[model samples]
Target chain A: MERLLFDLSIAIERGKENETSPYPPDLKGKPGAYEFTSRLLEMNCPPDTILKQGMMPGMDRIGKKFADGIVFIPEILIAAKAMKAAMTLLKPYFDNGAVLRKGKVIIGTVAGDLHDIGKNIVCMVLEGAGWEVFDLGVDVTKEKFLASLNEHPESIICMSALLTTTMREMEKSVTTIKQAFPQTKIYLGGAPLTSDFADKIGADGYFPDPHSLSKHLTGNL
Target chain B: MINKTFRFSTESLLPDISLILIEMGYSIPLADHYLSDLINDTLQQVRKHTRVQAGFIMLPKDSIKTQSNILFENRLLFEPGSIIMSQLQNVTSLAVFLATLGSDFDLWIKFVQQIDMLQAFVIDTIGSLMVEKAVDLLEEQISMQAMIRAEKCTNRFSPGYCQWLVDEQHQLFHLLPADFDWVKLQPSCLMTPLKSISGIIGLGKNVIKIPYHCAFCDNKSCYRRLKNRKGQ
Candidate 1:
């Protein structure tokens, strides 16, 4: 079981979505995360175990590589796409509560920023890490975040911005949410934001990559 | 509220070299026309003998003061406000030398036209790859350095954020080395390199540095904060 899980993780990391998908060119014509994950389910391997051990670890590697600059956006995006493809098979388990989530995270690109690449990457990594992510998408408003929080009181909030102009939206949202719910932890990121900026805005934390964020959340939980 | 810093160094000269290549009519793939204009401006003013070196440092919020100055001499984008201020420091002695190189209006015009042509060709092929590579190199270097220093650095932050006021450009400029004569920050706080970067990094021991969510922050009216908290 462990060996199969490791194989699936390697597939996801290499961006092998399925046997027919041709990516990472070197792995062409080989079974990918999709086939492996489906096979694991057919074999009655628990979905929770598969997600926790297989998909999460693969995402963790991709996130660390991204943070270390060992990989760029294109590579990370491919890995994320592969992970998402595998995730579709497990969605039913999640809905049925057979695969319990670590927690909920509300994520989005703050307002005035149309950029979604970074936000999408984080969302995928967090999902792979076993968190239920409520993606608010680009140009998210504070009201939407608050409403989401109201609906999912246990959810953690994350904000992203690629433009300097939109970074202010991240700060505004953090400040508003913290005031309303002081206990809620907020995570902020993007090309233009720093931990200093996050601190200045009184956010709970700031991380450069999703792997570090996932690890931090996992340890805390 | 964890403060951290990470730094690393690599022997990549691609960014600086690419700048020179663009000046010599070597087309940069995927670059927008405006980027070429920005690069041409730097090429014209840079000294011939000077070389460019760049570094980034992210400080704690309390370490830096935020302030704003009027841009365009009088045109206000909104009420004059302070956004997060980040500094991009470049040492360009050659740039200064090039600036002193006697100006030839005709040559300059022709150079501009060449850059326009290159931009048209490269935008589709490599809009920001060259510049992105440069930033990536610097980021990797700084991150490794920070890690060696035992400080976990978060991602780079630039000016125009919530707490760090864009108006604090002068303060960041103060931290820059005095030797780089070619590059200058205008009243609007724009860097001459056009390819140069300015941002902040948090230095500390913690692994995860949480950012304050703008939606929950009390500074609701911060001009730099994004207006849409929820999706439109």
Candidate 2:
């Protein structure tokens, strides 16, 4: 079971969606994450086991690879897509509370920024890491962020931006939330944002890559 | 002796330029360094590929300008506007390499070889061309709409340029796509392509028109210009 789980994780990391998927030429014709995930379900493996042992580990490897620069964006996108495919099969279990999420996170690209690539990656990694993410999408306003916060009060907030101008909106949103809820921890991230910039903006934390952010969040929680 | 020749057109790749750069091993932060080398290599390749009196134009600061013209297409939240400026004198250098389309045989062979170098050479060359073309298109578009030469771009200013600070990257984010392929800028205004650029242009008059040689300039804080001078 452990070996099967490990193999599934590798398949997902390599973007092996199924036997028919042609990407990662080396893995052609092999059963992908989709097949193995369904097989696990059919074999009566627990949903939590599949998630903890299969999906999570897969995303973790992909995230680590991204951080180390072994894989580039196209590869990461494929992995994220494969992980998403597997996650769909497990959604029912999560909804039924058989697999409880460790926590919830409110994520979005701040207003004036139409960028979603980084935000989507983080959302995928965070979801694979076992968080129930409330994606606010691109160009989210402060009101939307605050509304989401009100709805999911226990959730942490993550702000994403891809432009120098939109980063200002991130600062504004964080400031607005902190002023209203002093205990609310805000995480800031994006290509242009550094640890120093995060501190300057008064955010709770900053991460260079999605995997690091996932580890940081789960480690503390 | 690097004798390899490569080339690609920028006609269909205005927006996705950064994505191509990432695939070429040029990260956004390291883009400038690779760009300098790419430019040099491209010039050499052009020389070998065709016989044309190819040269580049290094605009002075005084010739560039920044003009802003707002346009409302729909009721979208963003009030779109173009920032036009004269970037003439401020241009550290604008070197262009042109090679006539060579004999069909050499052109075809070189083109195929260029495809193989896409991850290394073609991307940067295309990126440089796109940026230059973008500026030119922007200039022409702004001029046509404004009914005048709006402003001159003093120089191409990117993140971490001189003492301008990298934090300013946030300002440029509002102008670009959030997730441009693998090249996304985070909330902090950092670009993912790792080979992208951001810079400033002083519009209007009173702009300084300095020569290409950095040895004659008094601004000691100019990083790239100073580096070039030292190499000489």
Candidate 3:
């Protein structure tokens, strides 16, 4: 069982979705995250344990490599793909309360910003790290954020913006959301964003990449 | 004003996979078959969804005007900050350019996002490179045309970079012809069809093309910065 878990972690780290996946040539033709996860489930391994041990570690490894600039988006993305394959089989367990996520996060590109690539990447990384993410998509206004917050109360908020002009919308949304949920942590990401700007705008954090954000979310940073 | 448009088939503007990989953060050689296959598959999809619509207009030197942040024709006030103004101060003319992979690419990316986020991301990166490549081709044509008149081209500058307020895109749009239909700017100045680029390139005898100016710009995550990163 431990060997299978270790194999699953390696599969997720290398982006092996299944036995036939041709990625990470070194691991090609081997049983992947999907198969290892299936085997773990058949052995009655708890879904939470599989997620915490088999999946998160792999994701955490890739995320750290990404933060360190040792791995890039393609690598992180493939790892996320492998993790998603495993998550598909475990979704039922999560829905049935057998598996628990780390926390809830609501994310979006601030109003007037149409770019979602960065926001989507963060959402995937957060989900892979076991956060239940609520994606608000692009051009999300303050009203929409508050509405979503009302629905998913106590959830952390993450906002993205690619344009300096649209950053004002982020500030407005941050101010509005903070007013309604003062304790709700809000994080910002984007090309134009900075830690100083995050501080200036009353945001809790600013992460340049998804890995750092995940680390902070998991209290590993 | 000299205005021209082009509609290149997707085959002509296909971005180099190596360059795309570099932009995606891979510094090593292209030995990863997974990314290779994905990029190939995505390029196939790109061919189906992309039709590059690009064009440019050149405004005469006298028609151009400037101040601290720079102004065009005593109209469009561009707050492009000192970095861009200092470079543009020597330009004899300005070439406003627009390029897009069209609505099909946007629609395809959205559709794929619902099914496969990884593919969507790959396609998004490729689309960015494609649009920039289209602009590069257009710039080449502009350069060739300008060379006939003994003029040179400087690096293109967009409103969202070099401290230029993105809202100035609205003003830039006004300088184009009424029927200039290659791309559209939203009320927020975010270009529609998503994978689109609009900007100004300096044209003159004294204007010199500054290489790798990303170091001078603050937008750390700019796509060009990643593409131009050392070893990439």
Candidate 4:
């Protein structure tokens, strides 16, 4: 096990952003993911190794914890924040193809739903797992989803709705997009949604949490 | 034609704001202190443009004649049901109100969305608590005014709850004074500032049970249920 990579993972897992960051207070004076990642890049460490070993494992652990109900939204949120700090350092490598992304994802909260917390968390974890995410934000419509998919032809769609009323829009978009692009997959999630509801609405998959979504993408894509 | 606006100070909300930190997994004393520091920093940044507004329109008892899908108010008629029938049976008039956490919160949400999602989530959680608390404070005033008249009323019932179709939000928005322009209702019936809330409270003869506030409700997202469960 690489010590530098291991340190980076610990920083992200415990949500240590930088040396000055007061969170995970036990680690107050220690270098955080930002410094560790930056230092690793300078040390000629492979960007892919840092992402695969340092970032992904930490995020995967937390995502699993999140799925198991051991860690709640706030904890997952803070961890995602830590992963993002390191991810910023790695983005240049992703662009230059030094470290390849797993694939592209289009995710959003559907139209008529203003809630973005669930959708945003999912996006962060997916991106941390090395996917290029196109976040469509809240109140996104089927046309926008479809258009985004066309732009990133390799992208899979993930729609989130936090309200029962807005969840119907998921079914509507699922029905419409499935008809037009029969092979394309659309995933559904949010508080009021269920796997049963997703199947009823013709969605290809259902994610109860972001880690599950990330796992599905890793295994499937 | 009674219209009023309110601004709730965040300082006055100190005690109640603990739940926001608690939900952020900061319940223990030391963690609570650390998270409180983080929250205050974010609150200061967010407060620069924080604009929370709550508006109310008090109507006379004779103003509303509700019929399942349609409500006849004065000379105007609007459709779809958000009006709780049981609550209306004993009231002299109803108070229709709207509360918004403002576009600045939305802007802050967007700002933090990219930079600091944890703070963004906390901000999101706090905005909700703030708007709901503001709404409750306003409702307390209405409840007291009704008490003075010796008239009891039901708990608020908003559109999109119970059998009330969300489409009726159009009708509810119609009842509010247009001069209360802090919040806007979209064609989709969703309000802007996203954290905004609107509902009707009937001045009647019975104490109505508020949904989500009930301990018996199985909803994990209900703040009251969470509060009661942990005694927060």
Best by TM-score: 3
TM-scores for all predictions: 0.54, 0.60, 0.92, 0.86
> Between candidates 2 and 4, which one is better according to DockQ?
4
Candidate 1 per-residue C-alpha lDDT over B94-153 given as tens digits, one digit per residue, 9 for 90 to 100: 000101111232233334333332222222122133334445566566566556656554
Q: DockQ of candidate 2? A: 0.05
Candidate that beats the other on TM-score, 3 or 4, i.e. the better one = 3
Candidate 3 collision pairs: none
Top lDDT model:
3
Which fraction of the native contacts appears in each prediction? 0.03, 0.05, 0.62, 0.38
Off by over 4 Å in 1: B1-232
Q: Number of the top candidate by DockQ?
A: 3
C-alpha lDDT (0 to 100) for residue A31 of candidate 3? 91
Q: lDDT tens digits, residues A36-113, model 2?
A: 889898888898999899888888988898888766555666677677778889999999999999899999999877
RMSD for all candidates, in order, please: 16.9, 13.2, 2.3, 3.5
lDDT of each: 0.60, 0.60, 0.84, 0.76
lDDT of 4 at B195: 78
Docking class of 2: incorrect
Q: Candidate 4 on B1-232: residue-level lDDT in tens?
A: 5677777776543334467766554444343554677776766665565777777887765566544433446444434343356435544467888887788878888887777777788788777777778788888877876676566666776776544567778778877877566578776677887878898877644545455354333445433444455444
Query: Which is superior by DockQ, 3 or 4?
Result: 3
The digit string of per-residue lDDT tens for model 2 on B5-92 reads 1232333224343444443333562444323443444444433433211112223323322233211122121111221212233222
lDDT of 3 by residue, A32-61 (tens): 999999999999999998998999999889
Error of 2 at B126 (Å): 9.4
